[model samples]
Target: MPIYIYWGEDDYAIERAVVTLRDRILDPLWTSFNYTSFPPEQSDAAIAALNQVMTPAFGAGGRLVWLMNTTLCQNCPENVLAELGRTLQVIPENSFLLLTSRNKPDERLKSTKLFKQLATEFREFPLIPPWKTELLVQAVNQAAQTVGVRLTPQSAAVLAEAVGNDTRLLYNEIEKLRLYAIEQNRPIEVDTITRLVRNTNQNSLQLAAAIRVGDTGKALTILADLINAAEPELRIVATLVGQFRTWLWVKLMVESGERNPGAIAQAAEVANPKRIYFLQQEVQSISLRQLISCLPLLLELEVSLKQGRAELSILQTKVIELCQVCRRN
Candidate 1:
């Protein structure tokens, strides 16, 4: 149980997990001697890490060999795979091998299958998509608990809305709240969270909501707020695209008489089927045609942003056009 595979888009979460694992495996005094990290930029890092992990700890602690941002599971060379197979079979009990990646390991790959057979732990830390409100709220609560801060349910929801899927920000905010709660000697509430957390009121998801309702003025205002807050233009467009795409799929499924939430959730690639109910309600007013139309416009907006067009004005124009599309009968 020495091999670990951690992969996903949530880099912050993965790093945090790595820190925890490192702390558990290596003594603080002997860390420098026993801990070895192979960054992805290093040539032959995977092989190097394998070789390093096979070596015993220098002193009083177990050894930890980390292959950070590795792609071995996705595309391991024949030599590397053979080495990995040999290493895993005889890897020392006191030595740990950790492989981390941003991409999901292709399960079809032989390397992935080999890892699955011998991996002590395999965990994915996927970012909660902005549109998945429930998961975000759950993430907020879990982070708060980990940071030793107690949050009212309402406060958790508010914080989730504020941070969206930014795990780093969420953890920082929770730590801040924990410190404030200690000083104030009170439980964290919605009001406290609202006042303390920056950008609590505006986010890309709010922009998507405004566009969903065809509120041109509201969408523009949110767009301005997001821009003023220095949210990336491309990120804003990505959120919109994801939101609209989800709505389109849900709408298409519902209109075609598909009532099973699980089926619809699968089609939309949503994690929780229960959220499909809320999504169904959101898309009830808009036609599938309108949802379908928004994608091309969003694509154009993304293209314009990538093409080095003025961000605010370009975003403003696209938001207005999107609102207009949703408004059409």
Candidate 2:
């Protein structure tokens, strides 16, 4: 596809895909003339990217013009979309326009709609949520290849288990694993992942699990470790919200007489249906009233964090309070 569009929250994967395309299309020796990148934050650069794409390659190989890290997903002015739509028509087969953003493309935007018309050339790489182990494993494997790290199936499984659904921090762990493996002159293994990769993700999960079970002491300790690791309180709050939101959905579905975990997971947007079984068990101990109560607490924590009103200690205190409420009598 001459016109390529890639958008997703997986920033590292998005970048790697762009790099692969660049290597495949442009000549390195003539990079200055063959490739150009623009940030579409302003009108001029966005327009410039469009205008440049129609220009022919300098000497050899195809030319590439890129609109990188664009906010068009958030808001695309009418003029910009109109201009982009016009530019797409004139762009030569020899030149490629790469439109990418970390934000999911706004389906409602005119520009996004226009871009969608050329769907044959488009690629969307949305973030794979943590529960989708298979997708995470696939992405992790691809990343390992790019970063020159070797991962055995067992090692990959370990990494996938460590951060199955969320990949925001997976790249960081992969990079660290690569460095440590090179230093040790060995391949990445389950033990290597255990010893080298930070267990902050696991701890966060433990904190959420503890909160679900209403183990205040365990939850508070995990919170302390996460803070000591310099993990942001906002991030911690987001994680809790996500976990509880899933539990709440599962709980609601069960109360409504939904017996199928797959159906419940589909409704909840949980990528893995099999996980719904465990979630059902977790929420079984807590009443619907209790499950419903968790939402307001998390929302309050989020608002306080966003407003910069609460520090770590205050947030931890709130989490402890939440644990007490979640505990079954």
Candidate 3:
């Protein structure tokens, strides 16, 4: 019951715990350690290894056992999970057991006898993203500082947008930015951030980018893929409308004495700060008339789709036609 669990998709939180355990508790004191990563598909050997690792010996300083990326409760065979629970009951206090997972365990398990006892004896922390601007900015700053790279306010916003709430991807992208900065011997810039990080929202951003750039061919390709994936036209239209609004805000903000993309993004409340620069540039080419006119068309199409005035085939044709009209305007 001494197994502490730390769960999140946030890589930095998981990494910090891993490093702390390794450095302060395990490595410094010279405890023998075993780290096992159990993906959803590979539970058998991982569970068996955990059983073997936690079996204590009199002379051993203690074992440090780490189970990573496990989804045992959700996907494992019932017999296997039951065996795992039974195994958890016997883990030696002298041995430190750690579980790192992207998903939380079931609520039933959380209230069950074994988990209740484990909770009493062990610490549990969830490192979900804060989903607020301030915390996201702090995360970006902390990650950049780790590598001695300094971000201009604009650069930080770009990095934030490109990484977008995926802490693991943010760290990886920051590391890549660090490498790029070192290789080029330059301060980190927005373009460098854009070049390195591929955010989870990249496709949506790409669609926006293509539309902004008047790349009808690219826009059509992106539209076709979304249509094939069965994404609702109304939803797609709504997203684009929102993106374009953000772009317009950035454009307006920049022209009105707010030259920094980050500042504009913060003021506009755009979720992806990193996109502000591209958006600003993109918005410059779009006339106010086009922005005003296209939105109504998207809205009309949305209503039409909702009313079943057209099937997906017709809806897709309308989308392409909208793209052409927007680009031409």
* The best candidate in terms of lDDT: 1
The alpha-carbon deviation from the true structure for residue 120 of candidate 1, after best TM-score superposition, in angstroms, is: 0.3
Q: In model 3, which regions exceed 4 Å deviation?
A: 6-20, 23-25, 28-50, 57-62, 75-90, 102-104, 109-136, 165-169, 176-203, 206-329
Per-residue lDDT, model 3, residue 216, is 70
lDDT of 2 at 189: 74
| Clash counts for the predictions, in order | 0, 5, 2
lDDT of 2 by residue, 244-329 (tens): 88888998999999999789989888877888888888888888888788889888888887887857867887888889888746
lDDT of 3 by residue, 45-116 (tens): 556656755776345355566666665433566576677667776777766666667776665653233554
Most TM-score-accurate candidate: 1
lDDT of every predicted structure (CA atoms): 0.90, 0.78, 0.63
Q: List the residue pairs that clash in candidate 3.
A: 157-274, 158-274
Model 3's alpha-carbon lDDT is 0.63
| Local error of candidate 2 at residue 230 (angstroms) | 5.1
**Which pairs in model 1 have colliding backbones?**
none
Q: List the pairs of residues colliding in candidate 2.
A: 129-165, 130-164, 130-165, 130-166, 131-165
